[model samples]
Target: MTEGIRSGTAVGSFWAEEERCGGRAVALPSWLLTTSNEEVAATVARLYGGQSRSRDRQQDLFELTLDNDAIAVNVDGPEAVVNRLVLQQVEEHAPIHVCDGFNFLQPMDNAGDPCGCPESVFDRKAAARSGRGPKPDARLAFRLAAAPDLVIFHLTSSTWEFSDSLSAAVAGMERGDNGAQMTISLQRKAVTTRSGMAVSYVRPILSVIQQEFAAPGQLRLAA
Candidate 1:
């Protein structure tokens, strides 16, 4: 018999949720892998074997704790990820403008005219931070290396670091003829601001584990 129909293949999202602390939102230490699909929840439970909990009142949001700093992943190709800059007004669901930092991917008026965004990534980041322009919007889709056939897990981030590293990472992956094996980790770092105040934060990192390029007169073989 044919397999059951799959409507939404995305299993879940790996992300960090902020908590209320001292009347302000603070980032949590570990990442949370949450899903709303039952099948995805079951798959996650089977693979990770972690204690799952309902995070919402409707009991639809199932959250799995990822205490480890890193997880193995397999990316089908560069096309599996999309990183862009988007500008949205307050309470707007759709962005007013979108670009790749250098060029306008979505024109302001859909007239094919230039968006006039800053050409430099730094300048664009400043504009976004100052609420004058777009901010980073990135998404990645991959399968767990431990259970490749289970489901596709996704991660979405608006962090500037992730956006800045996308081009270089994708370029390295493109060098290979097939998919890439990689590790997605949460890296922690501390920095002192010019004001002499030290701040620490955790950011998600994507490190390619292996890239196989085709040799002269031969097709690349899968690992």
Candidate 2:
């Protein structure tokens, strides 16, 4: 299926969305990497846990999945305590992006699917910062942080900790009970094409930057 929704699988995560929901979508697909010393997988986990550092084996791999109405993510490989990527109930039509390439698909979930979206699925009111861009060039811009230093962490069933910045850890809070994933990606896009985002939302750009190393191992979402 070049572009068809799929269901049924030991999903690491159905993948996350590609839209910058904070407001003013201003980024093109790009590549944001940490030093070779920083493990990519561990850096991914901090996303749910916030900015925390860990010396655990959780720093394995990062997986993103977007299938139908579901957006899943696994910060590290299996075996992490705060491992939670299995989130369903996403916009009906959304982008299924990874570090390589992605596509859009509508949801076909059944009764067992995650709940429904509390708000409008395609609500772009936040990400659509519009005014009058030089007569109107319908294109949004985002700055890409190239080779920023990233720190990945594992949240024990306890307090929050980080190897980078405290802001990263605080941002990882979801509903209230911060018992999940957290990762912070940094570098500095110089003149990034977009606005405020740590590292989690820069995915669309990462996919494009990984073109050269686009091998099976270099980029592949877990199933």
Highest lDDT model number: 1
Indicate the residue-level lDDT of 98 in model 1.
Answer: 75
Report the lDDT tens digits of candidate 2 across residue range 76-150.
Answer: 211121211111214542222111001112233332353222233123222212311101011111111221223
lDDT of 1 by residue, 47-148 (tens): 666566546555768887765778887777655677777787655556788766655776555534567888777787788777899876776777788887
| Model 1 vs truth, CA RMSD | 7.5
Question: Candidate 2's error at 74, in angstroms?
Answer: 17
Worst 10 residues of 2 by lDDT: 132-141
Query: Candidates' lDDT values, in order?
Result: 0.66, 0.23
Q: Which model scores highest in TM-score? A: 1
